[model samples]
Target: MTGYVLRRVGVSLVVLLGLSFIVFLMLHTISDSPGRAVLGPKATEDAINAFNAANGYDRPVIVQYLAFLGNLLTGNLGRSYILNEDVSTLLWENAGRSAMLSLSALVLALCIAVPLGIAQAIRKNSFLDRAATSVSYLLYATPSFLIALLLIALLSQAIPLFPAEASQSSSPWAVFTDTRSMALPVLTLTITNLVVFSQYQRSSALEELGQDYIKVARAKGMPERMVITKHLLRNACIPLITLIGLQIPILLAGNLIVESVFNYPGLGLLFLNSLNREDYPVLLAYTLLGGVLTVAGNLVADILVARADRRIELTK
Candidate 1:
């Protein structure tokens, strides 16, 4: 297991390096001049040149890439052009909030999805199952932004349960503690995630129920509860584990829309602000951090899947 973890870490690092290169190249290609973009085209030519020279942007692409990598390895993410703050510091401050929001949504999703999915599978073709299927499909087909808006309209506007704007909270803790302010965003994400997870769980559970072991367990007169919990659910969750791993990154990315709709002060909102301000340092930092997180999440999923099913080989 240790060796497998080490190998995964090494691979993640390599993948992150490649991702950084791609992000850098894409950023460079999209903008005519990094210095001009940062300092503005109205700046004097000498000022632009000076800024470029100071930032090492005037160097060859390879040299700049090497310098960027070196700085990244040393824990330096550079300064944000718009915020005039260290990019690392800004990320550190915002990442926790985003993590909190996403993690809460994930928990809510699992709480609602797993049991409902299992029940639906157990009662296949029944009205309850049909209802579950219809709801899941509806949520899966709906846009996240639309969901957020609908939630805001219903819960925040009409019902007046949750606050419409999440940004009014004084701090991260305040947002978490104040259900009225946090409920809409959390619900939006939970609903979105729940729809997908429940559908996957339902499909996996139905497949596992048809397996020979399930038949044998039933034949042996195992209680329905034991048959489903100890045998069926255990094996059925393998694919769901992988789905969870993949969902981490998607959930994080999707938070952008959720955060925007609710005016939440998280990385998603920060990312949007950075884009609008053309804050390259922040944008690049967020992009690279997201890539690293994605790779790490996949590695964790691989290990967990292997642990859950001994037949799965990590080295292979």
Candidate 2:
């Protein structure tokens, strides 16, 4: 397991390096003169040249990229030209809120999905199964922003049960203390994730039920509940371990739309603002962080799958 983990980490580093270069090239391509963009449209050509030279942007692209990698190794993400703030500081301040929101939605969706999906599988062809299927379909079809809007209209404006905006307080922990404001955005992401998770759960459970071990457990006079819970549930959930790992980045991406709708103060909102302003430092740093998370999530998933199923060999 240790060897496998070390190997994965090495591979992840390579992937992140490639990702960084690609994003760097794209951002540079998008903006012909980043210094000019940072300085505004009215800035004189001489001023732009001075600014670029002062910031080392006048250097070759490969040299700039090498310098960035060196700074990254030293934990010094560059200063944001537009915001005039440290990119690392901006990330630190906003990452927590996005992490908490994504985590809350994931946990809630998993809790609901496991039971609901199991029930659907157990009561297949019944009214409960059909109803759940219909609801999942509806949720899957709707965009997250539209769902956020619908939730705001019904729960925020029409009834006023929860606040329309999620970022009511400066502290990220406020999401926990101020459930009223936090509920809508969490629910928006949760509803979208639930549809995917529940469908996977139901399918996995149904497949497990058809396995020979499940029938053997039942034939051995095991209680129906035990047969399902002890023999089936573990195996059914194996697939979801990998699914959960894959969904982490997707949830964060969903935050881009969901946070925009709810005016939530998170990485998603910061990313959008930086993109609009052409803040290259922040954009590049964010892209790096995102690549790290994607690699880490998949690695964790592989570890979890090994633990969940003893038949799987970790060293392989």
Model 1 TM-score on a 0 to 1 scale: 0.96
lDDT tens string, model 1, 218-297? 99999999998899888888888888888888887988999888888889999999988788888888888778878878
lDDT against true structure, model 2: 0.89
Error of 1 at 62 (Å): 1.1
Runs in model 1 lying further than 4 Å from the true structure: none
What TM-score do all the candidates reach, one by one? 0.96, 0.96
Pairs that clash in candidate 2 = none
RMSD of 1: 1.5
Q: Per-residue lDDT tens digits of candidate 2, residues 68-164? A: 8899889999999888899999999998899899999999999999999999999998999999999999989998989999999999999989889
Evaluated at residue 87, the lDDT of candidate 1 is: 93
